[model samples]
Target: MLEKVTGLSDLKEILHDKEDEEIVFTNGCFDILHVGHVRYLQEAKAKGDLLVVGINSDESVRQLKGKKRPIVPEMERAEMLAALEMIDYVIIFTELTAKNIISELKPDIYVKGGDYKVNELPEAEVVAEYEGRIELVKEVRGASTTNIVAEISKRY
Candidate 1:
């Protein structure tokens, strides 16, 4: 079973004993788990001791990715992410952006794909405020939900 955390406070208590542990965080819609997502996560986890993923809720995904997005529900997405041995924790947030969660968790390193500019993301400011590191990983081409959806639509 995947361990569930309700809020930020619960998050602190869970890592209280391991303050020195490097916490790497990443957030995304994760509507459909694919090779790109997995590779990105693995790279992020390599830089820290713990990998915490902040998943946008189903509602939030729709707001960002449009109405037809999030082919999978938030719970299912979170559960799938948690199942990966490289992912240490998964938190689902109702917000479209992960700024709130980033501030709350204050992870040692915040990671995003190369698609985003380091200075442009909301999480970037949060990481800056705490003097945390922000890593822009190499993007995986043809590994986006947009392409995935298009492929499915072409088939059916």
Candidate 2:
């Protein structure tokens, strides 16, 4: 259950054994898992040997997505991602940005959805410092948590 969810210290230890493996990292709120999220993660995994997802904590999500957001709890969201075969590990981060985690992990490839530009990503600088490349995955059209929530609200 919690096996795939790890803290920074434990993740660091695990990463030590993956020296020969290419690590791909991506961070997001992931409030509601959907086809878009699935496709994005699958594509991210294709770029490296292991895909490490940095999940924004509940507090961070509230700050970023608004107080009423994150209809799903952080732990549950992490569990859902961990259950996916495309995901290798899940790390919950408390900060608004994954800059610190990116700096520490120094993944071989840092991935983001097509909605973001490589140069526009704050983590891009950190990845650059480690000589890691940034890749933008194609987004699934008409799929987003906000839209999903709005549609749900309209129904009930």
Candidate 3:
């Protein structure tokens, strides 16, 4: 079962073995599940023993993706992510970024897809302070939600 943990208060107990496990953390909109998201998450799981995905809350998605985005609701998105075998836990964030959560979670490693340089990431500093590392996963071309949404709109 994929456990839903919204804040750090519940994570410590849930991830009781985090100190021993490689606890990999990553955050994103994940408004719609897709092949790329699956592949990226699968790869991320391989890098650690436990994979925790932080999904953007509906409000955060609206802020990052604009008002007409997040076709899927927060609960639906969380359920879909939880359905994935690679994902151990799903946390929802309502902020523009997961800096505060990262500080609280203090994951061993943080993963982000695409060509985001370590310095360019907002949470990089905090992760660095905790001696945590951030890795960038290769992005699959023609597999982005934005592109898919655009194509669907064009077809209809």
Candidate 4:
């Protein structure tokens, strides 16, 4: 599973060889894995031949989600995502947005949760620049890491 976790450069080279395959890209902090994340990834995989997940590094997550967030560290989060059968590759990035990765990979499809609108995504431009398709998967109602963490804190 750890083998599925790769750096951007290595993954780029590997993906270059897979030009024949339709590649799907999605990114998130994935601070705490949940059913919503699984379903989203599964749906993203269905969009193309390969699914590449870009995980926000600890610093990035901290910047986006606050310092107390990401109860699970970056490497552990990457490993957990890499272990998923539907995910073909996992890359940890230090960016607050997926724009850079999306620009570099130029995957055939870029996916996000339904909660996001295409016009609002910073990476949408990058995807569009390369003529990549953007997809939004419907989110599992009431299923989110923020809610889960809130519930845990309330119970504890």
Query: For each candidate, what is the lDDT?
Result: 0.87, 0.94, 0.87, 0.95
Whole-model alpha-carbon lDDT for candidate 1: 0.87
Residue range 17-119, candidate 3, lDDT tens digits:
5677899999999987899999999989988999999989899899899999899998889889988989888888888998988988888999998767888
For 1-156, candidate 1 gives per-residue lDDT tens digits of 367534567777776767989999898988889999999999999989998888998999999988887899988998888889898888889997899988888899999998889979977877899999999898998898889889989999
List, residue by residue over 107-153, the lDDT tens digit for candidate 4: 99999999999999999899989899999999898889999999999
* Model 1 bad stretches (over 4 Å): 4-6
- TM-scores for every candidate against the unseen true structure: 0.95, 0.98, 0.94, 0.98
Best by TM-score: 4
Clash count per candidate: 0, 0, 0, 0
Q: Rank the models by TM-score, top first.
A: 4, 2, 1, 3
RMSD of 3: 1.4
Itemize residue pairs with steric clashes in candidate 4: none
Prediction RMSDs, each to the true structure: 1.2, 0.7, 1.4, 0.6
State in Å the error of residue 2, model 4: 0.7
Residue 19 CA displacement from its true place in model 1, Å: 0.3
Superior candidate under lDDT, 1 versus 4: 4
